[model samples]
Target: MPHTKFPQIIVFDVNETLLDITTLEPLFDRVFSDRRILREWFAQLILYSQTMTLSGIYIPFGDLGVGTLRMVADIHQVTIEESDIAELKERMSTMPAHPDVIPALTRLRDAGLRLVTLTNSASGASPTPMDKAGLSHFFERTFSVETTSKFKPSPETYHLVARELSVETSDLCLVACHLWDTIGAQAAGCHGAFLTRYGNAMLPAPGVPVPDLVASELTVLADQIIGRQ
Candidate 1:
């Protein structure tokens, strides 16, 4: 919508972008006596996932999520039980798709744009988050960094999608709520659409391009894409 060429595939970032991670706040409220720790815990999970990737180390995202929860608990000097960790894992897998997800996805698919998801989490766990949230039907495929053995913001992850889809990187567009995720795809030579969800916004910087399109609502983003068609 910013006078840009339309991409052949729209690759979605699953967590937070498609699904609502904030639903896990009650778990944090129970574990740390403050629900806001949810944000810190997720931030640590992302930080360490990328850290491990940069160090040439590979750890499954689910495992990293568990360890991150423990690390954050330690940082806050809050004791977390195995039950809590189990509950956290359960909640993570069971998080709901954001209310706008289905309609936007439906519109995009109906408009004949290819749709898929790329997540840092495993591509196909037994009942992956997409499956659990009932959003899998909207996507032609779902992808994960597992195949590349590299977490995102590392170009290899986005490259994997292009390879698997047999398309040039330029034919793909990464639609995401996180600036880091969008920037990573842009660096990999793909278009980026930033969904400015709550708790997220653009941070302009030199030498790094801004997202090709920015919209707060997924529906609006969908409309923009459809308009381009």
Candidate 2:
């Protein structure tokens, strides 16, 4: 297990880390199959997020999901019914937690660590995919950049999470699978840990402490937290 001084509060990035959205890849291949189509959907998702951030528009991530799905359908020249949309949402609504997620969160909760989630997903809609994954019970709070009308990699987004948790940014640690996110947190004055899922190369962030500590799985991170104590 890696090591870090214990943190009073830990803020996690949702989506790719805790909840495995890759489950959709198979379903997507069956429907749209083409790699180009999948890339298009992902690209549009990021485009829409940037659009919302720049235009001061705030649409729930759920709505964005549905809309992006429809856009992909259009791109693939396929048609979807309201029922299809509903079914797609149902599929996403119950995202599966990664194998390492629950055990790690269980340990963190048992250790009395304050766990919270900070995501770029929209809020006040259906429960987050994480909540649906049964990990919501482990977190003390769930926050989204939608509340601040900004996406991450922006200091404002990190600051918003700290503000919502009522912790000084330095008092919190940001755990994420993406280097951009870890760098953003550090720039925003929070400590960071990068879950280097596959030894991905870090982007251009110097002085980032090479992630402070690295873990391939959340369970290892939990052990690190415990070891620190």
Candidate 3:
């Protein structure tokens, strides 16, 4: 993090970054008889979300999830019943936080960093996945790209966060497990800390802006950020 200065605020990414999405494996196995389809479905969800954002389209994240699940079923030539879809939606909103999440967040909070969340998931829901996971109290606020009708990697989404907090993009640090997400924040003039969670890693290219910090786990990244401070 030598090239990156300490940040005034830390914005987190949810989903796989904070929550344990693997919990859906059982549902995928029950429906498709292949638990690995959970990974494909998640990739589809992210891919289509970015596709929608780039095409200047906006829809609720939940709708896209349902559509992505169906798309996966169609691709695998599997039949997903209404019950399966209902189960997917229900499980998504109840997944537990990753074991590393609380300890890492506790470390950051104890370090006195202004912690908040900026997710593609829509806000204003009474019991968001974050709230359902009992992690809502750790954040000062939860931001949704729905506020700007865009998704992550879109400059507007990052800019919306900066504007809402009355801070320059440079003063914020986005900590996310997805490279495209951290890259997006950096491109938007914010610092980035990339967490190399499962199925994700840095894209090695001359054009890609390297994250300020890279760690394989959230706890490691949290320690690095605290050590940097």
Candidate 4:
């Protein structure tokens, strides 16, 4: 499909959209016995982040991650030790990028699109995950929701990116695997592209702002965007 318009700045969501977090399956299996708990843990991490935002409480994403892991462990009657938390954090900081990420990012950058990252990770973390993933060179900047003390899917988080870039919200496009994130960007008057990676799908709500582009992978989306140019 053709893009309606190309964005001046393409903002990326770091976690699963770009990085392959499946590498942690072994850790999850060792800790939770059921590797599926990794999915549950991540889902809870996002849920608690949003809940904290809605409740006017703000905590670093890393803190929320560890806390959510403990919560998930308790729910499953598993005992979680500090070592387990440390190990998880260590692995999280160094996830590898999805194989398609670097190529797609290069394609967009070669087309003169400004690329950047916007993640819910906190500022002052030892090593930003993108940098550890070796994908930092592809971006012009990396933003964290911690800077605004708000989690993503919040209008303020999306607005912060536009503000930092000194551009109108309409000139920014958020590319993410999360439908709520794209919906939030569109609601904030920015454009959005959805990467329909495995286990991710667009929302079926009639009135929600549909993404400007939707593709099965980042390379496909990049191709469409480049074609528009």
Candidate 5:
């Protein structure tokens, strides 16, 4: 990209960018039938993540999910057992990566790019999904900022990633599917790529580029990031 100094470390946002969460949707729907209810669950999850960060109240991301589910269950007047919660946690460890992802990551790793994963997912659920998808080998490290108690779109989360990777903010690249995430990374001084897997509309952001790279597939995005075809 523009022959600028490329980042020494490439950091990825896990949930939507690296690992596809679509498989977990069916399980969520089965547990909470209403689509609107599912939407609220996700909404509150982000809300609480920010709330925890802003208010200086940190909770383990897994515990936060359990609490969010309890809130949903209470509203629906249904009682959920602890075993059901454990099952949901188990599923997080099983969600697979996108079809194009492994080969793309392999290419980057083979090219000698240092890879790492940064996620807002809690410490209780650290790196299991990457391990399950066989992606753990591609990354030199995996970070769950349950330690920071913040989610993406927060400068703290982005900065935490760079700090943990022991790379300069300018020497770290952040690739993700969300616009807010790219903005946060850029704000935190990282080069950014928007992984638009579904061709979603780009939210307008002035001056600062929306994404240094944009691609519908991870393979193409990897090429651009590595200055390949």
Candidate 6:
């Protein structure tokens, strides 16, 4: 493969990209008998978040998660209480980072790359996911789509990061597990690297741009970035 040019600023996507949501599997099991319900709930959550953004409706990501969980519960004919939702939210705020995250981030930082995070998470959530995961110190800044009232896969959201950093779109490279996210970044003229984590793969869409870099994990992605430099 051809080596990709290094990006001055590396933008990271949170949630499943850096942190492991599977850590909440036990909590999910309590709310529904089927293990597949967790996956469905997350899919619905992302779908609703995108729907709200496209409709010009702004809702905090946390609220969307809770609402989607209730919707999922209703669909499966499962009864869930407010307390159950609260507990899930609590666990979400403190999710653990995947094992490879810290070392990979350290490698990138050590190589003199600027690292920052962009997430669909709410603006005022205490102990933001990064803080709880003990990964906040690695980033130079943290961003949320809440400021733009749009979610990932929206051109404006990616542009907002470039504008905030006073950098041109080409100077930024988004590293994410979701194909839609990388496609959105590339659409906005930023470079992208895709991490094909569990349940994620490159979409064979003809018109969409494929990411310049693809790796199975963050560590490998870091090595690719560093090797190219």
Report backbone clashes per prediction.
0, 0, 0, 0, 0, 0
C-alpha lDDT score of every prediction, in listed order: 0.90, 0.75, 0.89, 0.87, 0.77, 0.88
Best-matching candidate per lDDT: 1
| Model 5 C-alpha lDDT per residue in residues 24-125, reported as the tens digit of each score | 566566667753565566567768877887787887776787798788788888777887688767776687899989999998988889898888886444
Order of models, best TM-score first: 1, 3, 6, 4, 5, 2
With a 3 Å backbone cut-off (N, CA, C), the pairs that clash in candidate 5 are: none
User: Which of 1 and 2 is the better model by lDDT?
Assistant: 1
- Stretches off by above 4 angstroms in model 4 are 1-4, 125-127
Error of 4 at 123 (Å): 2.7
- Candidate 1 vs candidate 4: the TM-score winner is 1
Tens-digit lDDT track for model 3 on 1-229?
Answer: 2335678699999988999889999999998888988999988898999999899899989899999999888998989899988998898889899989999999999999999899888774678788888899999988999999998989999899889999988888999999999999999998999998888987988989899989997899999988877
lDDT of 2 by residue, 1-229 (tens): 2324556688899867787766666556666765345546655776787678678777777788789989889877988678767766677667798899889888988888899999877665557577678888888788888777777767898898778777778777888887777887888888787786642456655555556657888899778866765
Error of 2 at 12 (Å): 1.0
State model 6's lDDT. Answer: 0.88
Let me know the TM-score candidate 3 reaches against the reference structure. Answer: 0.96
Of the candidates numbered 2 and 3, which has the greater TM-score value?
Answer: 3
Candidate 3: residue pairs that collide:
none
* Root-mean-square deviation (CA) per prediction: 1.8, 3.8, 1.6, 2.2, 3.1, 2.0
Model 5, residue 158: C-alpha shift (Å): 2.7
Error of 6 at 59 (Å): 0.7
Badly placed stretches (over 4 Å) of model 3 are 1-4
User: What is the per-residue lDDT of model 1 for residues 4-103, given as tens digits with 9 covering 90 to 100?
Assistant: 5689699999999999999999999988899999999888899999999999999999999999999999999989899998998889889999999999
Worst 10-residue stretch by lDDT in candidate 6?
Answer: 1-10
For the record, the alpha-carbon RMSD of candidate 1 to the native fold, in angstroms, is 1.8
